[model samples]
Target: MTEIVFTPIGTVHSPFSDPRDMPIQPVGARGVRGTIELDPACAAGLQDLAGFSRIIVLYHFHRSNGYSLEVVPFLDKTPRGVFATRAPRRPNAIGISMLRLIAVDGATLTVEDVDILDGTPVLDIKPYVPAFDAYPDERAGWLTTTSGAARTMRSDDRFC
Candidate 1:
């Protein structure tokens, strides 16, 4: 397999300095505010992003050390396939979040409902178009059973 490489287009700035006690998912982090500082070289790409109310942010989990095929997720007690959980530790150490776009100024973006940690390297940003991104009737697998727990769950040392 060929190796893939990505350059950070920006960095996320949030109140979360430590993983512990932070919301495990965006649903749990609702109303949390943060900022994205896009590289000046990529500032031009922000041209029409303001028109969108939300965006999909792909980022690197820089602080995650290793991976496990199975993990006891924050939302459940039973060990589940890592792919089934949104745990930070993974083979790629990558994470994605859909955050509300509050405002766009030059190379900076003020966002809400942020679950990402501070200083996270952002790989890509795409507008969240409901028509193309929302799945109103899709099955959520195990998530359907434990999603309620996610709303009040917080990160711990388990995955760290």
Candidate 2:
């Protein structure tokens, strides 16, 4: 096996200090605002990033504990493989969110619908182009059975 390393380019500041009891997904966090303060060395990468209406955020799940290959997800009772659900506990401990870009100034970025915890380490950011990210006609697997749950589900101790 080989090891790969990544340096956090920035920190995310949000309303929730604790991971539990917060929105489990961006939909549940609709309108929740936050800021990403990029390290001075990485500020220049923000160029042209403001044009996108939405952006994909990749960050480390700093608070998540060790993971199991199968576990019960927040939206359902069944124990599914880790890869099948958006549960935080994973081998990589990396989380992703689609947030609405509100504004950008120097090394700071204003975004809304942030489901990530404050002080989380951001790995990367990418423009949310529907043509490349959205798949409306594809199946959502177990998500279909738990329809609309993400819009209301809140985090608990299940994965903490």
Candidate 3:
């Protein structure tokens, strides 16, 4: 296998220091505020990011220790294949969330609807254009049946 590496552009600062009570998804984190403290070296990349209302954040699941091929996700009781659930314990330990962009101040970004944990390393950020990221008719498999549970669900120690 080929080796790959990444350097985080920033770190997320959120109200959630512990995963036990955190939102399972962005929808559940509505109105929650957070900040991204970008490294000074990456400050120039923020130049045009303020124009977008939403941004997609790709980050490292820093605290997730290992992987499980199957997991009982926070929103469901049945164990499912890891790939089928949004459980953070994965081979890559990467996570993505689309958050509301509130403001950009030099190397710092103020955002809302943040579901990420505090101090999570941000791998990358991209403007969220609905035309490219949205697919209202897309099938979500098992999620189609259990997604409603996400609204009231919170992260637990199961995946920790």
Candidate 4:
């Protein structure tokens, strides 16, 4: 395997300090607001981003300290491979979430529906294009059954 490196483009600011109390998915976090403080050098990247109602934030689960190939996810009772679930404990502690864009003020972006913990390191941001990103009929395998619980689900410290 080859080693790859990335610097944080920004830090995510959210109300949840403890991962245990945070929403497990954007659906559960609807209307929950937050902010992203980007480095000034990356301010130019914010241009025209306001046109997007939502953006996919690729971030590092900086607080995740370990990796496990198999573990029980929050919504399941049985163990599953890490790749099969969105559990933060993975080979790479990378996280992605689609958050509503409330406003973009230079390098600072006010957002909503955030599920990530506060101070998470943002790897990149991309506009969410419904035509290119949505998949209404896609099969989710184990996720299909699990995602149904999202409406009432909130994360606990099982992964943390």
Give all candidates' CA lDDT scores: 0.94, 0.93, 0.94, 0.93
Q: Can you tell me which runs of candidate 4 are displaced by over 4 Å?
A: none
Clashes of each: 0, 0, 0, 0
Give all TM-scores, in the order shown.
0.97, 0.97, 0.98, 0.98
After best superposition, candidate 2 residue 62: deviation in angstroms? 0.4
lDDT of 2 at 49: 94
How displaced is residue 101 in candidate 3, in Å?
0.2
Local lDDT at 31 for model 2: 100
Query: Which residues of candidate 1, in runs, are more than 4 Å off?
Result: none
Pairs in clash, predicted candidate 3? none
Candidate 3 structure quality by residue, lDDT tens digits, 64-107: 99899998888778899999988999999999999999999999
Decide which is better by lDDT, 2 or 3.
3
Please, what are the lDDT tens digits per residue for candidate 4 over residues 131-159?
A: 99999999989888778788779888898
lDDT of 1 by residue, 1-160 (tens): 8899999999999999998999988888999999999999999999999999999999999999989999988888899999998889999999999999999999999999999999999999999999999997999988898888877888998876
Better of 1 and 4 by lDDT: 1
